[model samples]
Target: MLGDRLGEITGSVTYQRVLRDDDGMKLETSFQATGTFLGVSVSDVGTYVTVLRPDGTQYSEGRGIMTTEDGRTATWTGHGLGRSDHAGAASHRGSLCYQTMPDEWARLADVLVLFEYGVGADGATTSEYWEWK
Candidate 1:
């Protein structure tokens, strides 16, 4: 079941590159974001690779680290399947698993997070996360 909304972030894509282009196109992208999680303010940096098939469908896998104002950190990994629109926008719904440094934020280590991620045609990004209970 989906629990409470945990956080939301808005950012921009910082880097992108085409990694391959034979049978399918493989692209890599990195982003920077800032938001709040469990009432704590944080910033995030992540990189993901997406494989775009000939049919306009895509699969993505990514890992990222979130750090608090005081330097506590958590790492997460996730994957999703999505499709690119004709206008170049893409959206994905996925799940994430987190590992937190032993601290007050350790409770997140036991939580499952679900996310919705979107990229606009202009390279803007937005993400929202919820707890999966």
Candidate 2:
């Protein structure tokens, strides 16, 4: 994703992924943001759910998928909640691509993330990244 600060309200993001199964994939990700929207300093938690198509394209459901602390840092993590095309599968897994803004953009908020996922009987893979704006 890519965004710019409009006086106070600023946004930015960039993402990409690959398929790891034949049953399709599901990715749930969250982020912490501390920034002023419309010049009003604000802080809040945001979350999202991405349903991956067999061809690799995906869609996101906007909801609170992560949490933030009293300060300015937020941590995000998500797991497989079944697939869009199948409900009887034992499990599903995939990867996540994330980016963060600069501190000057978040004057009041910051973003942190812990991403993890699993494929079939394999265990989970976890990674971390940070962003502020």
Candidate 3:
């Protein structure tokens, strides 16, 4: 079994764009983050999209795949609840759970992860993640 500190992923926003619609423009952000998993460095590239509804609520969806340095890979999804600040940066609180991985990395299948996601007015983004025992 993997311990509490299964690993950490640290990356940056690779790109971000806005799509305008009737309600408002949707936000799309992509990032490349890397972390240590199972004693090896792993990398992930994923995207998060958010839409502000007419009722003043926010909906978000995210998906990403992780690849270990040696070639094993696994997929993860981020489902969250969010709201925008007065300045328009989205503040989100959510959990990220993952699918199965290869035999060598299968321990990740039972881990629990929670995170705080923040997108600043200047387009800078930061995330803090924790693994629950």
Candidate 4:
């Protein structure tokens, strides 16, 4: 597992479609992800799919595994949300966090990683994350 403060994920959008084009837009997207943890390469992170609505609400689900550069593996399923940020240009900001077990990681089952995303109501985007001990 990549803990909150140790690993970071990079995602490539694999699919995207407009579900609703009305004023409060709705979009569906899929992503192919990769990551890094404290100088270690974590590969084949997983596939992530999400639906985002103008109401500052987003729901996501994903299944993937992490393999350290040295070949240790950890798998997990994740789900999370984004809520309207009350003070930051109305951008919805929140986290998609989860836990997993890496074959060689001590306390493998206790890692919780969080990935955060945000889109400003003013037409901008932001991201961040942190995890538990």
**RMSD list, candidates in order:** 1.7, 12.7, 3.8, 6.0
lDDT of 1 by residue, 21-53 (tens): 665779898999988877888898999999987
Q: TM-score of model 3 relative to the true fold?
A: 0.69
Off by over 4 Å in 2: 1-23, 65-133
Work out the TM-score per prediction: 0.91, 0.33, 0.69, 0.56
Query: How does each model score on lDDT?
Result: 0.87, 0.35, 0.75, 0.54
Total clashes for model 2: 8
| Per-residue error (Å), model 3, residue 58 | 3.6
Question: Which sequence of candidate numbers ranks them by lDDT, best first?
Answer: 1, 3, 4, 2
Over 4 Å off, model 4: 1-4, 17-28, 83-100, 118-129
What is the per-residue lDDT of model 4 for residues 17-122, given as tens digits with 9 covering 90 to 100?
Answer: 6655444455554444456654577665455455565566766666767677777776666666755566633223334333555544544355455656544444
Worst 10 residues of 1 by lDDT: 99-108
Q: What is the Å distance of residue 122 in model 2 from its true position?
A: 23
Per-residue lDDT of model 3, residues 1-133, tens digit only: 2226455566677888987887586878888877776567888788988887767667878998889887888888987778987897777877778886768755557766777777677666666666655
Q: Output the number of the TM-score-best candidate.
A: 1
Give candidate 4's root-mean-square deviation (CA, Å).
6.0
Which residue window of length 10 is worst by lDDT in model 3?
A: 1-10
Give candidate 4's error at residue 39 in angstroms: 3.5
Give the CA lDDT, 0 to 100, for residue 120 in model 4: 45
Best by lDDT: 1
